[model samples]
Target: MRLLVAFTCLLAGCLAQKPQPCASPALMTGAFTVTTQNEKLEMYCKYEYDALGQRMRVKQQGTYQTKPFTRDYLLLFREGAMYQIFDTNRTCIKSALKDKFHPMEIPKDATLQGQVVLGSPSAPGQGLLVNTWTGDMPDKKGKYLSTVTEFGCIPINNSYQSDEYGWVVVNLYDNVNGIVDPGQLNPPDFCRDTVMKTDEEPKNFLSLFHNLP
Candidate 1:
C-alpha cells in the first residue's frame, strides 16, 4: 500500500510541473507600448527572422522627453545596419547595427514563476492562461520578468530593470504570425540620398530611444 501511495505522489508532482520553455513564432507583427523612466513610446513593429537573416522594423509615434515625434527604425542584423527615419522631416540616418539577432523566446534558464489567468477563470472563453517567467538578462546587465500565453508562447508583457538604464516595461499585443508587407522592411526612397553616419558611436535598440531627440 505504501509503494502504491508513493508512486501516486510522484506522478502527481510530475504532472504539476510546467512544460519546457517555448519560442514565439519567427515572423510576426505586433504593437507594443514601452515606458521608461521619462519616456513613453507606442510602436507598431514587424519582425522577420531566419538563421542567417533577421530584420525588425518599428514605427514609433509617441512622446519623448515630453516632445511629440514620429519615427521609424529598420534594424537589419545580418546586413549590420540600422536605419532611423525621421517621419517629420523625411530625413534618415544610417548606422551600424550593433545588436545581434535575438529570438523572441523565453530563455531556457528562466524560472517559471507560476501560471495565472488574465480574466475571470470561471467564465468560459473569457480568460486567457498565461505563464510568468523571470531570469537574468543574457548579458547579466539586468533582470527581467515576462508573461506569455500558455498555449502559444506569445509574449504579453515584459519588465526589465538595470542600474544603467533604469526601469523599462513593455506591453505587447495584437500579435499575429507572418509578415504583413515584405516591402515595409526596405528603406524608404527618401533615405537613399541620406548618407550613412558612421562617425557617431553605434547604439542598440534600447539606447537608440534614450538618445532620441
Candidate 2:
C-alpha cells in the first residue's frame, strides 16, 4: 500500500545540535539486534570501521519496523545513532546514550568512553520514536556531540499521519538535532529495534518506557 505524505524539511540551521561522525572511531566492526518484548519485531544493525578502527560508516535494514513496507539505510555515529527516518517524508535522528540511563539531554564533562555524553531523560523535544547509539564516529558540527554529557533515550515523535500504523493521536517530531534534506535519505533506517511502538498493549516496546499498558 502506498500512502501520500506531506513533507516539511528542516531549514538547514534548524538543527539544534552539532553534526558528529556517523559512527564510533575506536572499534572497526560490530553488530547488534534489539527485539520487541513480544519478539514479533527485530532491529538489526551492522557497523563498519576504518583502518584506524574508526567506524567510517554503517548501513541498516529491517522489517515490520516503523512500517511493514520497505527497508532503509542509516549512518553510524560515535556520539550516538544517526538515522534518516521516513514517515510520509524523511527526517534525521541524532541522539546519544549516557553511562547513566536517562531519557533527556544533559551535557556533562564525564568521559565514559573518551567522549562527552550529552544525554537527557529522553530526546531533545517531543519525539514519538527515539533511539540513542554511540557505536559510530564523532563530528564537531553534529548536535548529539558535546563536551558536557548525559544519557537520554530516543523519543518516538511520530507524526500526524492519520495513524496508518494504528494510531489516533499520533504526534510526530524529529530530534532537534535531526536535520536532513528531504529526498536526501538514499535509504532510510526502518529498524524495528530502533523504532518506537505505539500500541495500547503492555507488551509493546514503547509501553515499557512510556508507562503505557
Candidate 3:
C-alpha cells in the first residue's frame, strides 16, 4: 500500500513539473508612427533581449514636436515581447506641452486618461457617486462616497450635482472625457453628493495587457 501511494505521488509530481519550452521570437521591427496637425512624434528604437528572448526590452527615444514646441520622452519597455508598453517607467513625456497639464494628478500607480485627474484638494477624501453619464448633474439619489480616492473629478463630478442624468447636463463644469486610454492619462473628478470613493481595490496593471493579442 505504501509503495502504491509513493508511486502515485511521484507521477503527480512529474505531471506538475514538466519544463516549459523557451521562446525567442525576434523583436518587432518598425514603429507605427503618425503625425497630426496638433502633434508629430518619432521614436528611434532598438531591441534588447534575454538569453531566451522570451524576456524583451525595447529602448525608444523620441521627440514630441508641435511646430515651435519640442519635448523628448525617454521611453523603455520591460516586458511582453509581442505587445509592450511604450514607456515602462510610466512617465508623462509630453504632458507639460499637452493641452492639459496637472503636476498634482500623477499617482504612485500607472496614470491613465488625462493623468488621473486630481480631486479637489478641499474634497475631504476619495469617493464616487453615480449620476447621469456625466455623474455630475443634479437629481435625487441616496448618495455615497468612496474611500478609494483618486485625481480630480471633472465636470462630470464638478459642475453637476450627483444623480442627475437627463436630456440636459446640470453640471457643465465636468468635461466628460470618458473611456480611459492606456498610452494617455488624464485627471479624474468627483461630484457625488453623499458617496465618497473608497479604496475598495486597486486598479490592475495587467489589465492593460488584455488589449494585447
Candidate 4:
C-alpha cells in the first residue's frame, strides 16, 4: 500500500499544470552586462524601459577593438526614430527606428525547462524561485534561453545563439519596478544638432553592437 501511494504522488506531481505566462512591469529601470562571442565584445549598460509608451534608452560603456567607448541610444518606436550618441566624440546620429517594442517577458510559446531555487531553499526568505524557458527567436534564425523570477516575472538573464551571431548573453540585475526618471527617455542635449543618416538602413539594438568598430 505504501509503495502504491508513493507512486501515485509522484505521478500527480509530474502532471501538475505549468505556470501561466506573465508580462513584466510596464515601466522599469535596470542594469545589464552584455557579452557576445562573435564580436568578442563586452559591455555594461544602464537602461530605462517604457513599454506602454514604446520607448527605451540605454547608456553603454565598453571596450571594443581595444578602444574604450561610451555610447547612448534612445529608441522611440512611437516617434519612429532612434538616436545614437557617441560620448567619446560628442557626436549624435539619428536613424529610423525599425524594431518593434519587445516587453521583458518570457515568450508564451517558450517551453518551460524547469523551476529552481536560486539560493538555499532551506533558509527562509533567502531563496529566489525562478523559471527557465527556451524557444526559437522571433525571426526563427536563433534559439534563446531565458531565466526570470517566477513571482514578479523579473528577468535574470537571457542567452541567444545562431549561426550568424554565435552566442550573445545578457545578465540583468538591479532592476526596479518603475521608471527612475522620465527624463531618461529623452534624447540627450548633445543630440540637438544630430543629423539623420538617410542612407543607412535601420538596424535593431543588438545589431548595433555587432557592427560596432
TM-scores for every candidate against the unseen true structure: 0.81, 0.23, 0.18, 0.85
Clashes of each: 0, 64, 54, 0
- Cα lDDT listed for each candidate: 0.74, 0.30, 0.25, 0.82
Q: Considering every candidate listed, which one attains the maximal TM-score?
A: 4
Residue by residue across 1-213, what tens digits does model 2's lDDT show?
Answer: 111111112212223344332321222334434343343344454433332311223334444434433333333323333343555554444333222212222223322223322232133342222223222112232123222111233222211111122222222122233223323322345443454233422121122112211
lDDT for each residue of candidate 3 in 57-163, tens digit (9 for 90 to 100): 23344444422322222112222112223233433311111111112111233212221213322232332322112221112342211111122322232111122
Instruction: Let me know the TM-score candidate 2 reaches against the reference structure.
Output: 0.23
Which scores greater on TM-score, model 2 or model 4?
Answer: 4
| Model 4: per-residue Cα lDDT over 1-213, one tens digit each | 676666556444534656656788889999999887776678999999999999999988897766787788889888778988776777788998778878888877899888877884544455677788999998898899999887799999999985655898899999999999999898778886787777978867666567677
Off by over 4 Å in 1: 1-17, 37-52, 87-90, 192-194
Question: Which is better, 1 or 4, measured by lDDT?
Answer: 4
What is candidate 1's local distance difference test score? Answer: 0.74
lDDT for 97 (candidate 1): 76
Clashing pairs for model 1 are: none
Residues 28-143, candidate 1: write the lDDT tens digits.
87788777754444333434333234888887767766677676788888877889888678888899778887888999999988887788454446667788899998778888
Stretches of candidate 4 off by over 4 Å are 1-17, 86-91, 189-195
TM-score for candidate 3: 0.18
Estimate the TM-score for candidate 4: 0.85
Count backbone overlaps in model 3. Answer: 54
